[model samples]
Target: MEVRAQLASVFHLDKCLGCHTCSVVCKNLWTDRKGSEHMWWNNVETRPGTGYPPLWEDQQRHHGGWVLAGGELRLRLGSRPHVLDQLFQPPTLPTLDDQYEPWTYRYGDLLGADPTKDLPTARPVSAITGRPIDPSAGPNWDDDLGGSAVHAAADPNLAALDPDERQALLAFDRLVFFHLPRTCNHCLNPACAAACPSGAIYKRGEDGIVVLAKERCRGWRMCVPACPYKKTFHSWLEGKSEKCIGCYPRLESGDAPACFHACTGRIRYQGVLLYDADAAARAARAPDERLVDAFRDALLDPADPDVAAEAARAGLGEAVLAAARRSPVDRFVRDWELALPLHPEFRTLPMVFYVPPLSPVRAVRSDGARPVSDDLLADPAALRIPIRYLASLFAAGNERVVVDALQALAAVRAHRRARTAGDVTAADAARLLLEAGLDEATADAIHRLTVFPTLRERVVHPPLAREGEADRDPGIQGLVGLRRRVTS
Candidate 1:
């Protein structure tokens, strides 16, 4: 089966409060140094708006991810010759304007201004140029749907909807948005690693975390657009590509990632997933409609005896398999089938999955007294956030998967409300749960994991065998290899 253990995550979008605590903490920890001012290794993007590095999801323009041509999977960036042709000047690289210019306030101006003058203010200046400039954009400039007319209107996911539906989404009173926090997906088949001409980027075999070795980097900047998610960034000062490392140092010590740990909404869950490595390509090659299911099929159940034997033979430790058995990500993704990957059509096989959010019920006033739903829990189609829109974000234009996830979420809420508020009977809640294809016990378990999981239950780090490794530092290893090459 070619079983391999991979670290994975699940983010419950419904719980995300649009709080930037995750972003701020990730920034303070990883990308705060010079030349990385514009890089947010972790960023929370407001949906229905152009995300950071505007229009990154528009693969037609950026030419990121993979494509199947003549039944053979290949880089969407084109053949090696084409890549070489554009090596010096990649045609699809995002410009500085695309990624907002990082800036800082001129605090000195505020401090040194004449006392007699009117209230002194700090003028905004470019972090790069040290000159005063008008601040026009930021990573989360369109947060809470700010500048919806301009930025939100340009969202690429809107292209999937009909013209009328698109218009309705942009209408002032009808506007609805949600938070999408992002980082490097640490994809199973990372295009960034495949596209790196210098072989600098690599995915760790033990844990599937993609990382760039700075010592071997040649400042090619190829990984930038090669990543469909646009998580890889070029550092102008260091002349090397950088990205989120998944906070391996923290993970090695049995802790969750910085962003996951700092999240105010408790929306993040980290754990290990055991998947059949041989099946990844076939899964990625599946048709758009079946892509999500195909990917799910690639994840092997750790509890399976045959799978465990294969995993052990493949060098996975017992500790890792045990963690994988308790993995909340596995439950959310494979067991309950509630979480789905973002843009499965990208064919990167991202390990991180998201539980599609359930939006507030659309208000239809009756006699102008109050807004209410026709159905008890409100239909998925009647939610403020359209199932089609979420499908575009998560399911590769397949609305059915998104609808199923929302229905399951609704059932959980209904069950909880029935228990706590007594508005609905236990029988009624049971019917809703059955309708959603879940048993009462399963619903209750989902409720506990979603709303009130302990920290241990939230993040389950696998045994990486890092303790016994001799050459732990890549930098030192790189230097040793260089000295040997020169001496030889």
Candidate 2:
């Protein structure tokens, strides 16, 4: 049966409060277990700063995401199903020494002692690696992707100047900030689904939600790297790859995802969207403007009768169709034209939409003005929009996308400054943090941890043959050992 298509999304700039309430709610409901402490199915982060686990965006350094090969966007996971399945399996447990090592802070050791005239600052070192642990790195490092404070920290133009001078320069120049909360985009053409060897991952017919059948999963980790967003994760305990299921259980019952339900911003909206199934498949196989642009254009009118009819013919329920008719996303997507896809170039055809942030440019001036009324820096959320973060989502290999996106947001802020014709003082709090040299250090840390090794090694090597002797290969050793152990 043809599956119906539905969509949902969060407005990072408007609704999230970074309170961790959503994360806590989800943790207690789903991931609060022995192996889940490090896992946050729903995590909130401080933008313009490193996110949890740090620098997850430096996909180039980490060796993740898509690559353009022979003019096609090739998912890092091989095109074949078998190859992807083989990679999806869970990993074997490392020895305790490898998994859990003791940790301590060196500076903590000097707290109460009679110290030298100049007391040294605290530094952290890893007990296991015996190397100094840089404090500022992780998966979500650059959470705001260096849009605000991090940007100011990285740019020498802003770094060398004093606070007042920097504020004057910013006011003179005009700047802005925004926030982008992200999750699995659940693309119309999902690389994760295509890469599945067992055909276990499939998009639902009812709502276009993607799902993975645990029993059919062989624990290959191909999907982990295949997805540019890094949304798919391998469950070592379950020995399978898993990802966002679009909260199907709740969706079926007319509710929203755990993250959406718990979102304080109320920026999330859920509804059905109709796209030509044939077109979707074509886009999945061969993405281009003709196909992808058509789908995006349809999002502009998700509630059109023709669209609803098409969705119904695709096996969507009347209730779902009715919901789509009134969905706020439909209005935002079509009428207001405020929503845009997170990353269009990934060729995954993601469905989430974001309302561009508009706060930063209103804060500062380029002409050494006094203060302006339109500065976004006055608002924290406005400070969260970093081009780096968006570029991380869209431009997998290039850093320019992030720079461009940031500049675009900054332009918007600049426009606000021009409109308001006001002078403003830049917040020293964000500026001081930027000057302390923390952002880049943190981004570097996140990039290191998110690395997924793709080195190729033979699991079963051929036996070497001595001169004139028939040789047996070592391929059967594992089987033989298993048999012997079982029989004995």
Best by lDDT: 1
Q: How accurate locally, in lDDT, is each candidate? A: 0.83, 0.47
* lDDT score of residue 459 within candidate 2: 9
lDDT of 2 by residue, 1-488 (tens): 13344565535354445555666776687655544334455555543333433433434433334555675666654446546345535232122222123334776557765767886666677644547765444333444434445533443223334565455433424433334466677776677776666777776543456677788887655565556556666654566666767665665444557777776655556554545555544444443324334444445244566665654454345555555555555544444334556545556777776654433433433354545433333323233233334433333223343343333334333333433544432343234224332233332331221122111110001111221122244232111111111110
**TM-scores, one per candidate:** 0.93, 0.59
Which regions in candidate 1 have their CA more than 4 angstroms from the true location? 365-378, 467-488
Candidate 1 lDDT over residue span 287-368, tens digit each = 8998898898888999999998987676566777788899999999989999999998889999889998887755542233
In lDDT terms, how accurate is model 2? 0.47
Model 2 lDDT-worst window of ten:
453-462
